[model samples]
Target chain A: MARGSTRPTSRDVAQAAGVSQAAVSLVLGDKWRGRVSQATAERVREAARDLGYRPNLAARNLRLGRTRTVLLVVPALTTEFFAGVYTGAARIAAEHGFGVVLYPSPEGIGPARDPFASAQSALDGVIASSMAADALTAIRGEALPLVMLDSDPDGSLGAATVNLDIADGIRQAAEHLLSLGHRRFLHLAADVPSWTFEVRARELAARLDEVPGTTVRTARSPISIEGAVTAAQAALAAPGDRPTAVICDDDQLAAGTYKAARRLGLRIPDDLSVTGVDDLALATAMDPELTTVHLNAELFGERGMRALLAVLEGRAPESGDIPVRLVLRGSTARAG
Target chain B: MARGSTRPTSRDVAQAAGVSQAAVSLVLGDKWRGRVSQATAERVREAARDLGYRPNLAARNLRLGRTRTVLLVVPALTTEFFAGVYTGAARIAAEHGFGVVLYPSPEGIGPARDPFASAQSALDGVIASSMAADALTAIRGEALPLVMLDSDPDGSLGAATVNLDIADGIRQAAEHLLSLGHRRFLHLAADVPSWTFEVRARELAARLDEVPGTTVRTARSPISIEGAVTAAQAALAAPGDRPTAVICDDDQLAAGTYKAARRLGLRIPDDLSVTGVDDLALATAMDPELTTVHLNAELFGERGMRALLAVLEGRAPESGDIPVRLVLRGSTARAG
Candidate 1:
């Protein structure tokens, strides 16, 4: 069939068969007991087969008491990172006959006491990104089956957890920086205390600490370009030895650092080597581009959606972290 | 009162007053209806005021049997255009104690036949962006209130419409191009059959046709960078005469058109000028910021939500198109 060919409903089949649509629904839903006559059910089934009539989902969900809808709570909507995850999760959920509703909890922008109030459908389950912990204050202790993404994996709180292999990403980044013979590092961490960023910070510090003669300086910034510029400027302005390599928590931050480097008369990878997490479109859009972690947000979304469906179906969540890989770009190089 | 303020609940007030939560709900809800004694109602009211209690929205909505939730059905999550609309709509909705649920029917990224099924709550009304017309086809005939955004002003199917001043935006763009001594224009129109795009093509042609010796070469492209590139490339490759200005339907398409010009060794505003509708973040982020029409997606969204809310309240929708403005950035200049 071509695109937009047909989405024939059971009612269409019923009309063709000259029977009540309920008879087609019963036969298709496989609940045709004493209600639907055997001959009539067969005729309805045959007509439905010819018409490609799928049952009306709204009516089915209403009768089934569960809509197979999962609510995904996130911190913000600006970044494609979360959007990718949503797309990925939704893909998986669709395969299993589930729908995902994304709630970019208003708390990240300001104060949102309850994100669920916006996701009007009564949920069969929930998949929440750990970035929005403030919104979770209302979500905790609810009987809703929950799955946590990019959170403290060990701190399960009895909920299923999905995470990126951020440790590996950090390790790859640190190793690349260290291999470049960089003795000093500046870790521009996000000011937000998310487990994902925490992992980057801790792992970076630990890796550099292992190098006897290496030094690491820390600075905080909000996950934005301007914030990163300010934070990087201050971190670089110290009256001591300047760091040779700058590692940022996100591409947006890296973009800011790019401006900050330019302002400081620093050319990326020449005066300072910069690395970023989340290989966003902006990373590539940057003039010199950026070396960053390729977080498969869409795949992450697909996995999260799949995990929630599994939980709803009384199945265990798929184990292991969603692996993240570093994309080598022009932004990072040997310390000059 | 900063960041995480303690919000008082009516139940908390009731417990403090040694009264049932129902008494508190009734008194605060202003629906005692002989359920509570006048003296008890007074006690509940005083306790509520003393405790600074406010009724939770869920309970309030439940009591009213009307979920003050608006389902916003956008065609996509791919671009920031609809995202801004959602933000705008949501901001307006929040002021009235209403919540907005994104209805991702087209995303069919999930298996749910109806997008609202995943939102979990039944909506009192809906606001749909033009992109979701096919998805809206299934939902349009429903009893729920609906408001169409950026849809056909005339063919609103009896639903109230909140349209962008698209025709005016096109007219302004053409006039701006014309004023700059640009007689030849490439109408980089969206390939979709939607009414909004039709307006762009019609209005641009009509406005250009008004001026003697003015010419418009129409080129169709899907609303994507790649689609725009291919279409723009073909349009520019045409023999003999070439348009000095390209008017794109949206920002992403404009960005693609820029790439097409670069491939053909054309410089923006000098060799060829381009203007886009929907001043997305990409507008500024582009190399030469997009000279485009500022289609107020957020205002369109806000108005759509407001209209839907008004319809649900049995009130007339706000009449007339939401206005759009031309944002002249670096992408266009006086024809040399």
Candidate 2:
């Protein structure tokens, strides 16, 4: 072995090991299970180690015309939900020798400008949250394989989709409240225009419509604590009989409702009841704890990555929506 | 403009624009500001657009030996603080015609594996949080220019460092509590092994040591509401003169203190007063709100990116710690 300013190459390892360059490539790439003897592979690996030869991945990717890198396009990074998704996706990507680069769109689920340019990596595929559906136009222009998360399967323009059973979760929440003798309801909806939120609204309304005397008032706010506080305060202050039950789009909204209820001198499960989706850490941190839907963000991400991998491999993606469940906590009780 | 199976090249764009290939390159690369006339640049751009010609960034970066991209190595993405940092850093990077890629260390501020391989981009530099200090060893092996965030300036091995004035923030919190006549105190500290957390513990102890009769006890927990609840419960339940005031390392710990107080039939600011650092949304979301130190996370990120850019340009980075302030809410009062 010799050291110099110049880096050693694989050819030098082949020469040192007395093996053909192809044999050296196979051994180093870890694709020589049956093609080369174990002893020969060990010799090649030892020679490469002694010579300090590390393969130039960038150059190899360029030559192979496949970067083996995928981009995960999320709406924003301000929430831990998407962070969980990225963790699960990256875990799967690493297992298959692929890298997942995150691109949190600055436009907040709006039309993302050229993610390829922003990521600065030649990508083999993309896994995008449907909240950022508009970004798909630019992604489609590149003709890269794509998998959409929480998107309407019929409307993804043939892209593979992975979604949680959000409708079922909403149904469970409604049934729980209805069984607790709640009649009047306030639906605190996220103002974002996404298919997932649409499903929540549609499912909640349809479920409530089954009961003849049930009435639900709707209020919209941006998906933020401050925004939810302002919106919930106004709706709770409305005239006539106040809603006995409040169904929030997410845990943040439920947290805000707690504040609003406090301001109105309403007690949880005594004078008012609240429920939320996405049983985040905030749920348990709240005083009464929140009875809400639990969406497995990590599982959603894992499925999304798997679907993309299947698409890239020319195999059919796994079908069926991921399951979600209603977690009963202290926030919900019989209507007062 | 000709439509064909093969994509148009820069030579083809030059022919269509009736200019030399070098002139075409200048216009397309946005480097023709002084070399080419405004009218000629527009004409070349229009011709390229009409022919649907796009420059291949991967090949161009390989040739130039620069990616115009940088990696932001964060300890974790579970908190909104780092999200704010990424947003601010990315805003600055985009203005300078560069891209920022995020690599959240899976090991939670421990040794980060090869970020470049995971990012899958041949980067120009890195901006990292000192919380992820162990990852620096691998980064140093690549010899990429780096800027450390909230790291000890004397121990960064000559790398540029950007930091928040955390010690001063701690001083402010102490003074505010001391002036309120608090003598017995409990410090709910984060259990992370990082320099930032060490500063928090040291500063609190040193400041309390100033008063002749002041006494402070310390308890550590992972930075989560649930973890804080367990640790705070044990500390508050200890047999002794219960501390009238509690200083939390961050808002999440303060939230847990609130729960522990409730569990022990104690009311905030009546039986116990609580203060926290990092006035996150959880601060106001907690009942009675929370008085805390407000660290400017976005400004910290912007400064980190600017320092990295300075290093890349061979310029001296601007020196000074970013300022922080105390936000007074309703969580603290005169010691009972």
Candidate 3:
């Protein structure tokens, strides 16, 4: 399979199907709605599949004058959260004959200063995730097909938006925690000012406001375990009805909360309840496994890639917000 | 920068530098030695740099009839270690005006599957990391320039080999534990049969064997926190003075050891001492923080890329293993 010879091309598919090369192109191009009959189109698709006829990206790029490579602009690739998103997106991009190139917008160097000059070469579109809208001004130029993932759908700056059902996920978390008879709550929210986090803040507030006597306090951490520990420790030490339930922005934050509780002589799900988002590998690694929202990072990436592919083909994205679910584990329980 | 005009070429650089186009090409092409005088070459380079010139990758590929892109064959991209290698290699390649395209071997997907079928491009070379040499027979047919990262340099396949100073790193770790009066050690080794982990096992055993009264225990885990916890717990529970120190192959494994110690009523740097490698963010997140070896991921990437570039340009790479150092945090102390 790894021999140096070039792969069988679309022309090979045309010959195998005994159809005109143009017919093969039109059917495989997904542009034969009225030009070719449905039955004939299906024949071309079957033949292409049987012959294992992959498209020649170089030739198609030359003909169309646009490389089908989408630049996925992410904040960082070091974490499992973002890496999962990248994995999902790359898989989907691969399925549809498009290449996904990553641009981790210049950590310590900032995106505007050193965007991948090579990434700009022959890019068909871009999908930016968890980035400041203004930070994307460079990519937003020339009305490139842009899809924002997990960013503000309402306030996206000239880009199509695809997002997890984050507000609903928060609602689910609130319901799960509250159903356990917890009232006093501490939201271990991320200190970031991004819109996705804002959704968590607003949704948690709104959901808690429904119950009279429910109190919500907040602590901000820089989305790391140590940061979450320091912030959560101070938040839990405050003089008030101690929050029985703690909901964190991500699994790493949850791990920090675990440390904070240990220092304060509080035990998870017994003395203090905790929940986390982004069910990263860190969740189960905790002494008492963290209860967290399972944000399908790979699915998120896949959906983002699908949306970009939609934009590239001049078609609308297929559906609504991608689904997310809560995975209840060892970290939450009834009010004391 | 997105001006929709043909980017300034080498001809433009020659005019700007007030030199013949051939002189500019010779200097900018990194072939200035003996072909052009030092002063003239410096002037040409400065002019090209000031203009933010990039040699057109497409045109060069056409002229050479080979893509300047090198295919990186790895087992998977979902792994942090491999991702780190990719980051390291890509950074170095960018500096030398080469591109890296990843070709993750689809394990369990059978030999009928070839990565190049989907990637659909020819390459100037290949740099393989963490792949079985025997399984790479199909890939060996290309006769392309090749560099191996973290592969065995002895039964090797590539033209050049680059690796982290793993053996030395393990020695430093063992010596640190020994100096701290830790005679009984538990090696929380990764179950993967890769050469890198083998180096860790071999080096640690060798170092400890040299120290009188040293005792070593071994456990194999699947490189996940849960797997590490199970393996470490079983190992720690076994007899022989109940080893007070644990040396893990990676940061994630160290984290698991932390939980296992806590479960076994041991505290960090107190009843049990722990150490790890690859200083992941998890190291700093734990309550006591973790002491680990700082394998410079970016530098590793930069070196691999530089090596690939050198091979591409017919130059010699910087020799020897990239060194690693111990980042002592709060995870380990004297065996009490």
Candidate 4:
């Protein structure tokens, strides 16, 4: 029992407590209520604590055919939105005696590495974001249970899907802008070809199509403030009737649009109106607080983990998309 | 092998290749240079691929007393800084046939959970951020190779430390502001009681003390835009002569300072000047791009992982701090 020599085993605890190995197993496993006396169980527990005994979980999990660990695959962790997602997912995972490992697939760097090889843990299940589709081929090679978040339900190869109601959120944004007397519009789309971004484009177009004299021009940019600024500035300065409203793919894009507006001497809500999705901290930090769709990232992550857990347990995952809301702020007003 | 029946074992691969189990082991373990013929090794590899056989890394690693995996413990994943760190660490780890699992210790949520219990992997070592001090007690209980990132080298209990040259960065910032002829200053400090933030405060105070006719005040705020707005506004509105310059602990606080200045009808660089640390993307997004310190977060992470690897190999870690730079942007100017 010398410090740092080796981890004490259950047998060491039993020897220290003067109890049989079987009694130690039963008590430590929490299944000794009927067989072992209360006093003996307490003594065994005390011995284990005194010896700093820790069960070899890796060996035990291998024998049990479960690792009690899942992999949460994300596109990248560069923004607080995904961080919120991981936080919510990890909280739920801890409650269920499961640990969540993150695998952020390399973005446009190269072919995706096998997550199982990279995670180095025998995973019971996987929860993946659709934005990380580059890693799907490698993941599909394995026969583990999986749940897709922010994915197209009809295209996930029969995997359960947990998605925020992004289409509905887009509809709400469009309705709010249309009600504010906006007609000319510029859609600052994320250049990534993910199903979630596709939904944003599709829903916005559909909602705008319902109104007459509504014209929407599309500009694609990488999901970054710098990239958005370049794309937005070019589109806004094009030789034509300038769009009075800009609907950004996300808050970062909206922040860039604000910069673009500044360069063009267009004041927010006075000369132009802007709206964005995913009310990240940057949303409020803008000169005029962004009018954005507040998609609860933590709740999205919670539902994703819950769906993954259900899939692993041989049960049907909950159906229906999580709802989102439009938050009106200074960034939007009657079109000038 | 039938699809989804069971994972094909090395034995199945040997049988399919018509070779002895020992030959398969030598070939797959990459120890067959002299023992097995090249043709036979190629045949065995093809059989493994054809049968979809994967080595049981968990069981093999258990027997070898190594998991080829490490844990990265951070305070939170809510910022791009830590995300950059993880990316760098993971890149190095992958190159060495190792995997990294992140454990963002619960922030202010209660007692810390043992990362070993939650990661559920037999980790070979750990790379921890000092901001996550709450988890240090749990980590210290286990005997493992440890590396500290952004920690006080003198106070890490003998753990190897990797840090940015925060003190030098602060000196440069202070010199820049002082050269602009600022005589009064306000330090907008992060409320977190971590060694890195402490370094900023100490270095800034030490630098400003050398100059005559200079006075400074301090205000504390949580490292968020909203919290900074409240803190900066009150500090700026104090009854005494208002400080002509503000130096924030980080970029988020600087963004909040911009808002506070706007609320008080003060123009940046004209009515007041500002400086910050951590030149995040938000720095350039601000109307007047922030003058701040640029800490290479990815390099810090890479160095941390390299140090942990060196410790695991019983070698001395690389010494010296990673360098940082002061980026001059539009946020600062000569006091008006």
Q: For each candidate, what is the lDDT?
A: 0.78, 0.87, 0.77, 0.90
Summing lDDT over every window of 10 consecutive residues in candidate 3 chain B, give the lowest-scoring window: B106-115
lDDT of 2 at A215: 95
| Cα lDDT of model 3 by residue, B1-336, tens digit | 434565568888899888998898889778888888888888888888777576654455444566656777765544356666766676666656666666555533344344554344556677776544433665555456777777688866546888899899899889888889999999999887688999999999999998889888999998778788888888998866899899999988998998888788888889888999988767776768888998887677667777778887899988999999998888788888
Best-to-worst ranking by TM-score: 4, 2, 1, 3
lDDT of 1: 0.78
- On DockQ, the stronger of 3 and 4 is 4
TM-score for candidate 1: 0.80
Cα displacement (angstroms), candidate 1, residue B293, comes to: 2.7
Residue range B157-235, candidate 4, lDDT tens digits = 9999999999999899899989999989999999987999999999988888998899999999998999999999999
Query: How much is A119 displaced in model 4, in angstroms?
Result: 0.9
Measured against the true structure, the TM-scores of the candidates, in listed sequence, are 0.80, 0.93, 0.76, 0.98
Misplaced by over 4 Å in model 4 are A20-22, A107-110, B108-110
Tens-digit lDDT track for model 3 on A84-116? 676677677766766666665554332353343
Q: In candidate 4, how many Å is residue A175 off?
A: 0.6
Which ranking of candidates, highest DockQ first? 4, 2, 1, 3
What does candidate 1's lDDT look like per residue over A10-121, in tens digits? Answer: 6788898889877777787789899888888888878877765545444454456566778888877666677777777777776676777778777322366466656545
Chain B TM-scores per candidate, in order, are 0.84, 0.92, 0.77, 0.96
DockQ for candidate 1: 0.21
